[model samples]
Target chain A: MKVMRETIVSTARELFRSKGYAGASMNDLADAVGLKKSSLYVRFPNKEALVPAVLDLTLQETFGQRDSASGQWDDEFVEVIEFIATTLTDRGRCVGLHLAYGTSDETPIAKHAVRAFFQAHRDHLSSILSRAMPVDVARDIATDTLARLEGATAFVAIFGEKDAMKRAVRLSIEEAKNAAAAKSLSSR
Target chain B: MKVMRETIVSTARELFRSKGYAGASMNDLADAVGLKKSSLYVRFPNKEALVPAVLDLTLQETFGQRDSASGQWDDEFVEVIEFIATTLTDRGRCVGLHLAYGTSDETPIAKHAVRAFFQAHRDHLSSILSRAMPVDVARDIATDTLARLEGATAFVAIFGEKDAMKRAVRLSIEEAKNAAAAKSLSSR
Candidate 1:
């Protein structure tokens, strides 16, 4: 039963990514899961309930560990950008990020999920940035970097174009590498 | 009647900024405007219609001029950052930018408005940045700069705190200035 529920949620996450929260109907969800509509309701009372479940799953999958412990901030920055590009480019990912800002005024669930996502992202980026710069500067740089990524994500989500955003991501990675290199030179 | 319609749109813009499109009810809008809800509908068929009108007004007021004829790219960059800071921090602004990303999946109207907004913004910034660097480089810098600003705006919109985003704006301005100065030095 637990495995079935997990399967349902993972599938629903994909639906939400491709079709969006409002676009993905319960009927579609049930059809994807091969479950009767009534059985789907027995699990999730409404679409809203299903949405946060999908959010949780995406967050878990996308934000695991840095994994590239090359001990180089520049290398990690590039890896992080690569991860972001993959997630943003995937048609069926970052649904939570979309809905968090998209439906924030109307839905507490969305607002809560988005808030948690930003906080977690902020903390993670700040910690990573602190390795090369002062804590305060790192915090600012982290905020700036994440803002660029999210901005690019939002741009693609709105317009379905990746070229401009991809260019922005590349420019950001270059800037981070330069900053790190400059810091090392100054210290030397 | 036209004046009244304009007044309603401007007021609705404020409500949307403070409360978000989903949060601002017709009653709240009517109460703010000193009119009955029925009369409000006479001007705007529904809330969705009202939102785009507000977006038009904001774009007009905020982006009317690049007036920094001083021919200094650094001055213009600071002015642009200042403009963004004012727009994001204003108690009743940037609602369209937020809603564009937030309602993009569900509403074609939102998607259209956001796409136009981003395209216009990119054109405007690229034009300004071209004064400092080659056209291609200017376009990339413009894209990166706007993404950073939008991301910071989204961060503040979600978290209800402006400090991190504000810091990002400051840092971005400094970077732009330094970049422009470096380019000028190379050309010299």
Candidate 2:
């Protein structure tokens, strides 16, 4: 039963990633899962209901269970940014970002899930940045970096320019390093 | 008749912005436009056909017919970034970007329209930045700045952080100024 449920959630994630929320129908999910519409509904009451599960799974798969205690801030930040850039620009689509933008206030649960994922990402980035700069500076840079990465993903999807993400990642890392170096220089 | 057509296109743009490409159906558009499905088809042929026209109108409305002849690169760049940030984050949605992300390879015409819009934006930014720095440097900065703004829009929409756009705008402007200043110092 657990395996069956996981299969449905994973399949739904792919469908949502490619077709989007409205584009991916319950019938399509059922067909993809090789189950009847009734069976799919029994597992997930509706399309919106599946969103939380799908997003949770996506968050886990994309970010994993890694902690930010690596103590190597630069390397860890690079790893995170690289992972995101690669995943987001891989097939020229970011399922998480796409779904987040597509979600409306009408789907509060889905919106909450989307918010949670982004917040987690932001928090992760802030923690890493704080190692090299003031807490507030870290927080602001983290937010800015995340936003830049998200925007670069959109550019990749729209223009098919994978270098856009590379540029964003490079610029973000350079800025973070410069901030850290500036702090050190000032303290000296 | 032209006014009615304009009304339909504008309404469709709102729907696409709010609900995304897959979410906004032909039936919904017809209902919003107070036209029968057949009537909507008569005007547009199909939902996909409306994408190009809607995008063109959106580009015109969002960007207008401004040329980049302004020698004041810093001010001009700021204006463009501020305008994009305001329009994209207003109401917490960017119709052009949302449509672009939601577009699929199957919709070649729609995809082309999205690419063209972003390319025009990049070109505009590049032209402005070239006045302050070397052309190559200006081009890279323009691409980087635009990605940051685009990413900031998604952050604003997802997290409801209006400050995200403000921060992006400020950072972009600061970076452009710093680059211009550096070039002057080195040349002297």
Candidate 3:
């Protein structure tokens, strides 16, 4: 029964990633899971109830072990971009982006969950950059870098332009390196 | 009759912007426009057909005369960021982004329309940057800048942090200025 619940949540995550919050109906979830509507309701009660579980699974899968042991800021930053690029180029679109755009005025729970996820992502990036620059500069660069990444993911998702995503990643890493270099020079 | 048709398209655009592509059903649009489902179908034939008209209206409203006669690249760039920032912060979310993310694999027409809109937006930004720097550098910067704008807009839309959007715009403009200055120095 526990395994079944896990499977259901993971499947629902995929559905949400592909169809978005509003687009993914409970009936669709039931159909995807090969369960009767009543059985699906028995498990999740309602669509909104499943959001936390789905988000928990997403947080685990995407953001697990993000810290780098090597402590190389540039390498860490590139890894972040590569992870985003892979998600965008691959079949699975950015789940957070889809949820961010798909959650309407009606779904406050989903909205809050999505917001928390993005905030955490931004904070993580900021922490990674802080190792190389001042806290404020790192925060700003992290915010800007995350925005560029999210934007590039949107472009890739919308346009199916993998090359554009690649270019954005390359440019983002180069910009980070330049910023770091400039900071070092100023300090010297 | 034509005015009513235009009104329906505009209202549908709003619906699409808010509810998303898949989330906005024909019944909902019919109700929003105060028309029967049959009547709505009489005009659009189907939801897919509405994608083009909806996108056409969006293109006209958002991208119209994006070209600046002032010929000052920095001001024009800031204008672009301001436009995006305003859209994200305002009640009306970025329609293109909603369409881009809300569109599922089933909705090819919606997908194409979204792709075209983003491509045109990128091209316009690139053209603006091209005037002040090397074509390749300008193109890269334009792409990066657009990605940042889109990402920042997403952040504002999801998190409702207007200040972050403002900071992103300020940073983007400063970066553009720095890039322009660097180009002038290199050329000399």
Candidate 4:
């Protein structure tokens, strides 16, 4: 049952990514999931309830693997960004981010979900960056890093150029390193 | 007549920003523009056609003013980003870019419209940055700058924090300046 629920959420997430909340239909989700619309509703109640479930699953499935590695912080940082880029290029799994940005002004649920996700992601990134720089500076770099990566992901989605996002991520990492170096130099 | 068309497009753009393309109904647009749905179609045939027209008007209205001022490239560059951040925070006037990212995958019209906007913006930015650095480096910075600004715009939309976007823009401009300085030093 757990596996079945995960499958349903993952499939819904994919549909949401490509078709958007307003564009994606529950009937299609039912068709894709190999269930009748009635059965799907038995599991999810309605589209409104289903979206948050899908987002939670996305958080777990997409970012859950972020903590498994034991490499150096720099390697981990790059790997984390690479994972996000890979997701954006591979399946446009960042659809929740898109929905959040698109309709959060009118939808409190989406606003909360996306804001929590971004804040959590920023906090995780800041913790890693703080090891090499001041906490305040690290927090700023983390915010900047998330903004660049997220923006690059959107650009790739719009333009279909993988390299554009890759270059942006690389430059952001480089800039953060440079800022850290400059901060250290000034301190000395 | 031309002024009326511009007013309609600008008003539709605002509706699209706060509401996603799928979420922004034709009725809502009609109401926002103080026109009946039938009259709105007389102007735009359909919502699909209306979006691209709105995007073109947005390009002319937003980025059109980019070249009117004669100032140092650095100041102009920062000013452009500030302008963008201002738009995102001020009135949420960046709905076209949002549409491009959100619907471009399934809609060819959206893909083309957004691609053209991003490409043209990058080219314009490249022209400005080229004055300060090598063309190749300037182009890279231009792309990076666009990605950052676009991403920061989305960030502000999602999180509703104006300062986060503002700080990201400032940092990106600073990093670009530093990159130019480093390139010059290497050449010297």
Best by lDDT: 2
Query: lDDT-based ranking, best first?
Result: 2, 3, 4, 1
**Compared with the true structure, what per-residue lDDT tens digits does model 2 show for residues B1-188?**
33388899999988998898988988898889777777887678778878888878877875686665744778788888888888877857877777787777888888788788788778878888888789988877888788888778777788778887888888889888999999999999
Q: Write the per-residue lDDT of candidate 1 for residues A135-168, one digit (tens) a residue.
A: 7766666666677777777567666767756766
Predict model 2's lDDT versus the native. Answer: 0.82
Q: Could you give the candidate ranking by DockQ, starting with the highest?
A: 2, 3, 4, 1
Candidate 3 off by > 4 Å: A1-3, A66-74, A171-188, B1-3, B66-70, B174-188
> What are the chain A TM-scores of the candidates, in order?
0.78, 0.90, 0.88, 0.86
Q: Select the stronger candidate by lDDT from 2 and 3.
A: 2
Chain A, candidate 1, TM-score of 0.78
Q: What does candidate 4's lDDT look like per residue over B66-109, in tens digits?
A: 66438898898888777767877776436856576456545677
Q: CA lDDT of B1 in candidate 2?
A: 34
Model 4 C-alpha lDDT per residue in residues A80-128, reported as the tens digit of each score = 7777777887764367566674545456666577677678778877877
Q: Residue A44 error for model 1, in Å?
A: 3.8
- TM-score per prediction, in order, is 0.78, 0.90, 0.85, 0.89
Cα deviation of B55, candidate 2, in Å? 1.7
Per-candidate DockQ values are 0.39, 0.71, 0.62, 0.56
Which pairs, if any, clash in model 3? none
DockQ of 4: 0.56
TM-score of chain A of 2: 0.90
lDDT of residue A135 for candidate 3? 84
Task: Give the worst 10-residue stretch by lDDT in candidate 2 chain A.
Answer: A62-71
Residues A1-188 of candidate 3 have per-residue lDDT tens digits of 22398888988888888888888888888788788667877777678777778877877766686755566888888887688678667853777777877876688888788888877777877877787878888777777677777777776777666665776677668767877888899999
User: How far does residue B142 in candidate 4 sit from its true spot (Å)?
Assistant: 1.1
